[model samples]
Target: MSLPTWELIRAAGLTSYFLLFVSVSSGLLFSIKAAKPKTNQLLQVAHQSAGWFSLLFGLFHGLLLYIDTYKPYSLVEIFIPFTTKDEPLLNGLGTISLFIMVLLFISGDLMKKVGAKVWKKIHRLALPMVILISTHGIMLGTDSSNGWAIVLYASSLAIILSLLIVKLLLIKAKTKKVISA
Candidate 1:
């Protein structure tokens, strides 16, 4: 038997959201590690290119929700989130996540003018935003019930979290070595 129409839409949305998440995370990781001149240049190019693609696909993913008639969502619900009477909390969090994503997109281009120190402070928001966005996806998304989606989401989380832990450990080790020297 063919899958239900709603299932297809959910799958599409989940896939698009996954791509957006990966693109942003990869861009951020590349940016943070890009210190050397040649590597920095390459990373910057990759970040910008991937960022644009993520934004484009993310917009399309959001629009698809509106287009899917089986579980049609209004423009307001699409943008505002949590406006859906059926699920207020998840939708509200999703709205906040969307706002954070917008800030990330805008601030990325303005990092130079904003000053590296100040931008670094602002960029810390990315971690929280990603967590919130992922939570929103897990809670409100239709694909939340799917085993594959859960596995993908969890894997992404594990990778990011592991990278962060390693980065911190390395920093601390370097600091200790410097003090001893």
Candidate 2:
């Protein structure tokens, strides 16, 4: 069946969101790799560039959703969780994920001012937000059933999870060394 023009526009918006997701994930990976003080400046530059791109695309995606007018969605529907009739659960989670995304973006900038401990606590929310975003995409997204989308989502999540695991192990090793000293 041929998609209507509205559907086409919606699809484009969703595709932009997906691209933002990928770019943000890659940026995070690059940032993690660049955590070393020296010899990883290139990754840091890539991280910063990709981060800005992701933010731009993400804003565009959200703005397109608001402006499309194909569907009768209110600002409440876009921003508030579980406020809409269509796909309440998914939309609710997505709303929360959006808030978390905003928090992540802000915290990235505030980390310098807030110090590492506070920033780490705030950044921990990224994991839940990622999971919520993944769930929201799969449950409410039109392309969720597509094999490539599923693979891309799963792989991105896996990469982030792996990075978290490595970070945890490194922390543990450091703690053990401190105790042994």
Candidate 3:
């Protein structure tokens, strides 16, 4: 039995993006100390779970493209940046985002060995990963012009950007407090 590769690719990509949103939101909440201690623990778990699933779904999304009868992608084309004939730049961004996601996942897992500072530095790549994936979807996705997809892209970008700004403000405030002491 053969599955519908194109539909699966779209579904997986959308699902991955949604999970990434959840993960980022949860991570921001956790980092900002917005929840109570008990709830914070739950948020941490949610963040980790969502991140793992996001990566999984993202990999599924990319792999499905390899098997797509309409537009089959070679492993090299899919994994390497700017190697595809179709939409090279946008697809390259997606490919780079995928590598960043994988790096984030691995660095997170090896946080202890990598040290907190290094892990945090690598975690910062989440911002660019979101941007790349959003651009890839908005520009290259087949459903990008649809109302629901448009809403999803815009709203997700808004929410994530808002939270990021809040996180930055909180960091600045904390720094000021430390300096004033």
Instruction: Compose the digit string of candidate 3's lDDT tens values, residues 1-181.
Output: 7778899999999999999999998999899998899999999999999999998999999988898988899999999999999999999998898899999989988999999999999999998889899999889999999999999988988998898899999999999999999
User: Lowest lDDT 10-mer window, candidate 1?
Assistant: 1-10
lDDT of each: 0.69, 0.67, 0.92
Count of clashes, each model: 1, 0, 0
Model 1 quality (TM-score): 0.76
Q: Considering TM-score, where higher is better, how would the candidates rank from best to worst?
A: 3, 2, 1
Candidate scoring better on TM-score of 1 and 2:
2
Residue runs of model 2 more than 4 Å from their true location after superposition: 1-39
Q: Is candidate 2 or candidate 3 better by TM-score?
A: 3
Best by lDDT: 3
Which is better, 1 or 2, measured by lDDT?
1
Clashing pairs in 2: none
TM-scores of all predicted structures:
0.76, 0.76, 0.96
lDDT of 1 by residue, 23-119 (tens): 6556556645736777766766765665566555555556666767567678788788678666777666666666766777777778888887876
- Using TM-score as the yardstick, the better of models 1 and 3 is 3
Question: Which 10 residues in a row give candidate 2 its minimum summed lDDT?
Answer: 1-10
Better of 1 and 3 by lDDT: 3
